[model samples]
Target: MRTEEYAMHDHRRLGRELGLFDTDPLMGAGLPYWLPDGAVVRHVLEEYVRDAERAAGYRHVYSPVLGKRELYEISGHWAHYSEDMFPPMRLGGEEVVLRPSLCPHHALIYRSRSRSYRELPLRMAELGCMYRSEPSGVLGGLTRVRAIQLNDAHVFCTLEQAVGEARAALALIRRAYVDLGIRAARFRLSLPGEGGKYVADPELWSRATALLREALDGIAYEEAAGEAAFYGPKIDVQIADPAGRESTLSTVQIDFHQPERFGLGYIGADGARHRPVMVHRSVVGSVERAVAHLVEQHGGAFPVWLAPVQLLVLPVGEAQEEDAHDVVRRALALGLRAEVADPGQGTLGARVRAARLVPYVAVLGEREAGAGLAAVRLRDGRRPGAVPVEELLGRIGGVARARGAELWEAS
Candidate 1:
């Protein structure tokens, strides 16, 4: 397809064409339902991030989606960001609101027990679901949804450890983007300026901003004055699409006010209690937005590991049905996502064309079945010709395991 034609494979169109997701007006705008294929992709991505977090010494936690209205008030979000949050719902005697961020909840968890300096750098991670009252004019597919599953985490540490924690967070974001073949278009140091949206304490803001600068020193980034969050200064990693539209995919913020506001503290080596500095970070900002980016980045042809259907077994005719089923069984045993195309559904060419969206397709016929082999065809038009079943499995399995971006090394 021409580049212009291929650009039409935007997430909205591809989501419908591939049966990935859907939306309904009756249910509500900005809410999406993930179909089976899309759910598989989501599951894969979520597991990948979970494993990465585990290896990084992050302790995962599950927090409620709703909290008392006073919780946000303590976090200072009620005063600064009330316009973006869903209205408080009165349940019985208490007013509850859908949580707009996980920072406050994590802070509450840290404050639940007395902590010491030895446990200073506590990393809390969650796949937290949040709701925001986004304006109808700005809601666009998965990119700007009302509900989001944020790959959020918070690090509570002493002021001395804050810079290292920020660096660690940035490293995680770099590794994730590299593995997923995403290009970091630019780095932005968003700082507070004359805007009244920022926290009122100038001294706290100055300290937080200085720490962020020290952590980001030697890193190539441009400063954007007046773009900081209400409670902190942040480093935003912006990713550009094929059309050069940029979106913030990863962020790390240094927060000083929220910790003090929430009265979160740990006993220092001097035997004095001091508030712990909080570092807020997200490697893949929002899982839904990540999916949208990947869908457009790969043009619906995901990497082997991320593809909903990694392989398709197409029998030339009904005579090779058993062979096709056998191939699928073997593929499944090897942990490959494979499906057998029904020969009775349509012509072999038509079926192959339809299944071309999948990464690999194995064609089985009387010649190949009798020879105990199958002709492997790659979607990228690389025909490796007839190969033994075991070799085919090994090759594709290796690619899936390695999460290779290309079908053939030469290609």
Candidate 2:
């Protein structure tokens, strides 16, 4: 697709047309409500990340969306990152704020119990919700929203193990991008610039930056000062919009400041306490932004595995309705998101057009339905002619299960 066409594939317009998500004046600007279809996509993506994290030895955890004001104060967010954070709310004499980051809670979780050398590399992950106090002018669609569901994770590891952990996190980010078909615009090493809202610890900053550099060893990256988080330096996986505007989709950072501030440590083999380095990583930074990019990346034609509705069954006429419904049921049984386009809803041609973005469309007519076959049409304009119902289901299911980029080749 042309660059301009990609720009035109704005998620805001496609979202409404495809009935993925919506926003309202009464419901507030940045808080978008995902329609049923959008919810399916988001759920699948989140589950994928969770499964990946589990396989990578990351223990999933849930933390409250709101945190005590003193928590951020201790983490230095109140000092260095308060502008982006929502204001604290007075609650029965104590104050709490919607968390802007998940690291503080994870830090507390790590410190909840005494740790030994064996658990040095404890990876904690969460699909946590956090709020940003974005201005009214910046509140756009899914890309720039007030409330974010971040695919966040942090590893508390000994200083010696920090680089390896960060490298592993980078590999996970790259794998996710390949599976999701997202192209990285560039890789960036975001560092502390001349002067900004950053932790003023020279020794810790230098150590964190060097570790990130070592982790990014052979990878090509650009250095951008003042782009580092308040606490550390990070390697950011940048993606571009249709207009060539770049944004971070994934990141791996090494932080030494938070552990010191939170007084986190582990018992060493020599029977002494030592601070563990914090590796902050995200496979897909924000679920909302990832989906927005996916929406534009494939236009509305998502790959079968990620597509909200993988299969659309269309009956030639009312006489074939039962057969169409049966096909949908069978597809559903194969773990496909299948639905029949009701004959009463529109003409067969119109129905097919309406489901143009769907990865697979099965047309059931009297001949095919009677013979237990389906005339399958792929979204990429390929027709494999009429095939037996069982074979069609198996082929599509296999491809979807494999998360392949294309359907089975036509025979």
Candidate 3:
């Protein structure tokens, strides 16, 4: 697509132009409803995340959206995120609340198994939909929402292997982010404040926080006092957009207390009972928020792979409609996201130009469909011409599977 054709304001104009999702006052403003197009975009992101995670040895799992209040009381969620959680429901005298995170559910899953040391460093992931009770005013398009689906995971490992697993997760996150087009990064190693801002044992906090620092020995860091979870230290990745605005996009946290609280244990090498350390990470934060960042980062030109509609065949007129339809049908059959533009809408040049302005779009008509070729324009700066379908498919697949900040060029 031509660089000059893309609107620089597209990042903010997403809600107005794409209208992928919307929130209503009567339905409670902070929540968003994903339109068909938005769902397609989100699905693209999530599938990408799943493939990345699987490559990193993560096993996916499904957990409940709500848990008993007692569960949070045990995992420290109530003390830390109660304000962000939905009010508890009295279920036959027991309190239940919508979950704000996936750690507790993952811990529960661990407890359900009588794990051996061989299963040490067990990594479980979930792209499951979760909920919180964020205030209405905080909601902004896909950036903030009361309900969200997270790209979350938990790694349970022995104290000795904790750092190694953390480093692996860090590498995994970095790989994903880099492939997705992230460039400059801020690695914030979070710690406890001086006067006991955290909820765990003070000495433990000091020792654990320092341990994290040691793990970050070579990497540049900014210390964030009181920015950690109640039980441990965290490494947060804050991304810089083209406009220079920064936002926290990914996080990896280590918890020393929660596994013990739930008695999630396994037999050690010495045949002794041992509590595993838990590392909770949400590499993409929330799909809602991640999409917001992506919109801003590339200014809505979501690389060829992530584009909601991979290609838009612009037929010159009614005479070319059959060819365009054939192109669209073949693209769909091959599992590619492609569509056809309306010839009656405007001039052929105008239609082609409009399609190019979107993240990923192509003009496939008369000359090429008959020639069994595709006219391609990439989100990165490639222009039209004809190419074999298999060749184009392979390149597009590579782009879709890519993760990280370097995934796309800036607007």
Candidate 4:
């Protein structure tokens, strides 16, 4: 409540102090327990991911959070990225590993069926909760938790369709960010390095990387880089926080070697079996990391749709309580997450304090009952004095529709 006090995201101490989430020392670090409000934000992220996947023709499937250990071995993941995984467990005398990525599981899905050329580009998506046993020091808040909910998926397509899939993923990420009014992200066409883990032959990496690069031209990135995944080169959507830290939040990696590693193939139109290229892409990165980025980026002042509660109807007194209920009912009917603050909680100052602390567009005062007008205040502790209740609702609804960064940008 002090003017100089930084928000929870601005001050890590504040996040833990506020009870949004928790990190435990006894849990061996990088682990978090989601409070009820934190869970709401996580659910919001999944909804965004699902909407994008559906529009892009991705079929959703729920896969087990843990996969048999041999599955990673067969996919060459154990050989390269094993250190990131938790210790394997004994399941029916076989080792089972908590999934660190979704590609291997998705590969098994593709392997479940006899392939047809008509289904060359099979897009499979899952918001798979996975575990990566990062050492204690690597976990910081939600940004680098040991447990991760990954918005992960894969596109199994004939080599010719790989570029199209990559471009589609790029378009979806850009569109989602633009619609959210986030113009800070920069897409990088990550290229392979000299002696990189790319499919051994230099020519294949160059060709595939070049093809993906061509798709990124004119997309307006802050810069490009030679940093790439081991299997292939692709795009990494690098985002920066206000604190000047940069991290890749979404990635589209072209994996030419993985299909061959697993002997994956489909009947081509030419009537012969051919290896399909696998594009591993994630739109929101680890939901934990995405949440951390968003918290810091907006200083924990989330936008309307992303906000846990879009608005809090604040009645000035007992007389206006029914009208406050009316406003809350209307907001809820319109599908904007709305709630009526407990009138008995405390004085008006305490009500405003609670609303501001929880980040809600607070509607206050008696004008709301007189002419169905509203005394509007933002979650950021901004009061718009008084305005017509209908007009206030329209304004807040527009902001929520666009997922605006703040409720009252004009004021």
lDDT of each: 0.90, 0.92, 0.75, 0.76
For candidate 1, the 10 contiguous residues with the lowest summed lDDT are 402-411
CA displacement after TM-score superposition, residue 339 of candidate 3 (Å): 0.4
Instruction: Please give, for residues 1-411, the per-residue lDDT of candidate 3 as tens digits.
Output: 234333353344664476567766777766777778778878888988898888888999999998999999998878766777889998898989888888889999999978879998898999987787877676666766778889999999888877787778778778767666766478998776654435758666776676677667787889877677767778888886555656677888878778878998999878888888888888788898788777766666676667778767776678778877887787787777888889899997777667654544555566766776767665455664677655665555555554322323332
Model number with the top lDDT: 2
**Cα lDDT tens digits for candidate 1, 23-142:** 999869899989999999999999889989999999999999999999999998899999999999999999999999999999999999999999979999999899999999999878
- Estimate the TM-score for candidate 4: 0.87
Off by over 4 Å in 3: 1-12, 194-197, 358-370, 373-411
Please report the candidate that would top TM-score against the real structure. 2
Could you tell me the TM-score of candidate 3? Answer: 0.89
**lDDT tens digits by residue: candidate 2, 1-411:** 476686569898898888999988998989999999999999999999999999999999999999999999999999998999888899999999999999999999999999998987999999999999999898889999999999999999998999999999999999998899999999999999877589888998899888988998999999998899989899999999877788999999999999999999999999999999989999999999999999987888898899999889889999999999999888888788999888888788888888889988999999999999999998988988899989988888888878898786655
Q: What's the CA RMSD for each of the models?
A: 1.9, 1.2, 4.1, 3.6
Full candidate order by lDDT, most accurate first:
2, 1, 4, 3
The runs of at least 3 residues in candidate 2 whose Cα sits more than 4 Å from the true structure, single-residue gaps closed, are: 1-4
lDDT of 4 by residue, 1-411 (tens): 333443444525545554568866787677788876678878887898898899899999988988888888877768767888888999888999998877888888898878987986899999988888788776677877777889988999987888888888888877777654455457777776665344475766777777777667677754344487666777888887665667788888888777877889898778898888888888878888777776666665677778777778888778878888888888777877778887788988887776665445455566557877777777766777677767777777887777666667674
Q: What's each prediction's clash count?
A: 0, 1, 17, 0
